[model samples]
Target chain A: MTWSEYGRLFLRHGWLMVAGAAVCGALALGLTTVQEPVFRARARISMIPGVMDWRMRDLTKELARNAVATFPSDELLAAVQDQIGLQTDAEGLRAGWDDGELIITIEAFAGDAATAGILARTAAREFHSRRSLQFTEQDFIEFIEFEIRNREPELQQIAPNVMTNVLAGLFVGFAAGLALVLMLHWRDEEWLLTRQAIEKSVPQPVLGRLRSN
Target chain B: MNTNPSSRQQDAQEQVAHELRALRASIELACHKPARSVVLLSPDNSVPTADAVWNLGLAFRTDTSSTLLADSDMEDPGLHLLADLDLAPGLRQWLEQKGQPASALAATHDHGLLVLAAGCSNEDPLQWLNTESIGWFAPALMACAERVIWRTPPLDQSPVGVLLAGSADAVLMAVRPGHTRRSRVNRAQRILAQAGIMATGTVLVES
Candidate 1:
């Protein structure tokens, strides 16, 4: 259909389209509002390529080293869990490997905001202490500097997934709306008489014509 | 009055007569063959006189039986003046009585044409022009005449919206040149559409 025909059709049944859009927008807002709010606490720890010095190492790492090395393996998640007291605590720590940046992210989902913040900080501390023991004293100080530099830029890059999730929901809603509009238009028999069909089907009285060979 | 005065009047009449004849021939060509009922709808008292007459003649010639011109325009029955007939009881009286004798309501014109007027004016003439009464009158009028030619009121002004009550085998709308604008013609068409009267063709009445 030409733009004019589309405009005419809409002029004829714009109310139906408006109703469909209203229903879709209302449903999207209602669904989002009624959903339970989930807050995610994320902390990032990157792998720096050196070891910490003996004298310069912090007390937080020195105290946690015994519990950190008991695992006998270099897995960042298990080491961080043991150092953070998650292995003996009431609620366990949740930490996972970041394949993209060679980083380990420790996240905890909780009903309250304060508990989630503390848990994220505690896990980061534990992971840092465990990472310190894995290298020499000189290497550890260099790694700390490297970690700080890497983390400054990396933390800036890590954003909450709320925006992505919201946009995904919007896309789904829009697609459903488009499909619904098309379905309704399909059912409307009046729209079936396209301009092409009108010109071809109806007998037109030809007064004069110029034929081009 | 001398012969010259009469001759000038005669010349004007002759011009009118020539124009009417040309209009008649055009309509005849347009409506060469018609179904059982050929209904003609107009919006006002200005009947598509020559054109309708011309078409009716064509319809009469081509159709199996005789054609009847039944004027159902209650407001101003133009056929009474055009066909030169007495103003008598027509569709309105038949509807008012509901079951009045059809024979008494009709009059034969000098041309062997049956003319049914809107009858003498009433306080609320339109009340009888409703669908129910029109439904009763249509067949009764058709039974009295063979092929019916309805001189209906202009759809724009008439409350009934259309002239014919039942399914018209063929219908035509007549518009006077220069007088009938496109909008009025469209409005009249819409009126006919609402009344479920679909015209087979249209007649352009040259002034």
Candidate 2:
């Protein structure tokens, strides 16, 4: 279609697209307004080596890194998840070791502050209990006090970034509506409405034209 | 004498007279041999084809040439009413009742122009135009008059319009601005093309 035809089609359907955009924007705003704020709490876990020796530095670092990597396993996490109040599996929970290979930070985001704090603290405790079970009676002396310490639990509420979500919804809805309008216009072939339109649609030249009242 | 013609009526008369003169010149110049029978119609059915035919016939009659105006529109025959002529013993009577051609000719009581109105009849219009009677009427009218003008129903409304065009030597389309849609014009053109008749010319009629 030429620009004139496109202009005509858009003139008819642009309002529909704008309406769709407004509906989606309202939906985004409603969702943001109704959603409760969530709180995120973090618990840091630091692994300590039994013996500090220059020759054993690499082995100590390796052990600490492995412990950090395996601390959030499902079997270890399930041990205390029942006490945490929130229904979170190992896959749904998040943990990271950016501070150092020796330290892992377990984090939980929950609708309430109590649930977030409980999840973070319980996850750290479960890791210690499972690590202790790995040592035998005779080796218990070498790995004495295999217990986890909780640092100051960081807690903050995070929810409803209104501006970002509304903007995203507006853009997505506008794009979808525009695509729909173009598709519908393309499908409608019987849209000739002018003297030039008659000439463009059919093979015959328009010898004469009469205007509509 | 229409002595009390209003200003609007006078203006309409002057416009029609001027347009008729221009149309007469167009008719003569459009073809080397002037058409014996010309079909006059409008795309939007706004132009009074009967009036155009009657005035054109009057134009020829003043020049000492007798003209025959036939209204083949059985649905709403206006040629008789427009010219104040007798409706009976008309084209329908000639086609169905086998009335004589001379009996069908209505004296318009204006400048000796003859008219053949679509008289009171319920006969199928398409069949009436296609019959062997009109087959004889075409050449017979050509021999009987100097020029012949005919009016049929709007082409889009009736198949008789294109069929009537086939009986005539030329076709004149009256298109009124602001009344006829472009699509209507295109459809009329398509119908004419389908009937193997090209419009001889177009007359732009402004309200």
Candidate 3:
């Protein structure tokens, strides 16, 4: 089809796309209001070697790896929960290690910013205290030290992104509407509405076109 | 700029009249010889066949040659109404009673245009159309005027329409966009082809 024909096709059925976009956009907007918002907070704790020794650096790296592996453990979660009076279970807490920075990152999610920040800060503090106690009677105590990189939790609201969800809904709705219009157009093939359509089916020449009364 | 309804209607009518005149020229050019009798057929009633025939008759009128418009579509005759003539004493009467073709013809407002209405009859028109008298009806009507134009029923709906179309010197099909179906046109074409007839050309009716 030519560009003009495409233009005509869209002109004939463009309303469907507009209506779909409108309904889907309204639905998305409505859902944003009803859905619960989620806020996220993160705290990073660095593992540093107290002495400038290769063995001590290697030990600090091993300790950081171990901390990452056990960061999401139930025992750690229970301790953090007791410290912060958390209402939710272990579902809200997560941990990861950035090897390049020798940092163990603690993240927490909650219904509000204050609780999320407190959860992340309390988890980081509890992990540091437990690791310090574990090495209090060993020689590793003079080789490793733990420092909280950010005294305050970095907080953000991450869920129920209104603009992104609404935009996605409108795009999907428009695509579906276009598909329906094309299906309907092809289904009614027997109708000869254009000169090209009529000419394709008949052998005789079209003499002239007369306007409707 | 002229938003008057009457003016718009008149403008539309003028445009239709102009297009009909162009169609008249096309028909004249398509036929090799001077076609004394031309039959107009449509795939369905949605097309304005009667209106085209009436306008073509008016367009064909000239100082030298007279044009006779006949409504042979007995099932749904409309040319007579377009010409503001009665429904009786027309082709039906001429076919039932072997009267002079001139007696059945009614003169219109135009001096060069005459009309032969689809006359009233008690019996079925198919019976009258099938008779031997219908064969010579064209020749008899041609004798009354220089040009004869017949408006028949939808070719796909009535077998009588195809039969009448076969007797004419030239055949023209009328089709309306969005209303006329491709299958119906194909069926009409098949029926005409079965009788060794083909449409000389087609007129695309916007209506």
Top candidate (lDDT): 3
- The Cα error of candidate 1 at residue B19, in Å, is 11
Per-residue alpha-carbon lDDT of model 3 for B74-145, expressed as tens digits? 877787787788998888988888879899999988545899998963344676776475677767888999
Using DockQ as the measure, name the better of candidate 2 and candidate 3: 3
Please give, for residues A1-213, the per-residue lDDT of candidate 2 as tens digits.
679877987898898779778888889999999988788888876655567665444554555567667757878666666665556766535777643445667787777887878877777667656666664443642643344556556887777778877987788789888998877654443333333433444443323322221
Tens digits of lDDT, candidate 1, B69-124 = 66565665555665555556666666777764354344444445555665654334
Better candidate by lDDT, 1 or 2? 2
Over A1-213, each residue of candidate 3 has an lDDT whose tens digit, in order, gives 678867977898889988988888888889888889999999988888888688888888887888777766788788887887767677788888886777888899999999999998898888778787887766677677787889798999988999988998898889888997787565444677777677766788888875543
From the highest lDDT down, the ranking of the candidates is 3, 2, 1
**Which candidate number has the best DockQ?**
3
Q: Give me the runs in candidate 1 sitting further than 4 Å from their true place.
A: A1-213, B1-33, B43-65, B105-109, B122-125, B159-166, B194-197
RMSD to the hidden true structure, all candidates: 16.6, 9.2, 7.4
Ranking of all candidate structures by their DockQ, best first: 3, 2, 1
Q: Tell how far residue A37 is off in model 2, in angstroms.
A: 5.1
Q: Model 2's CAPRI class?
A: incorrect
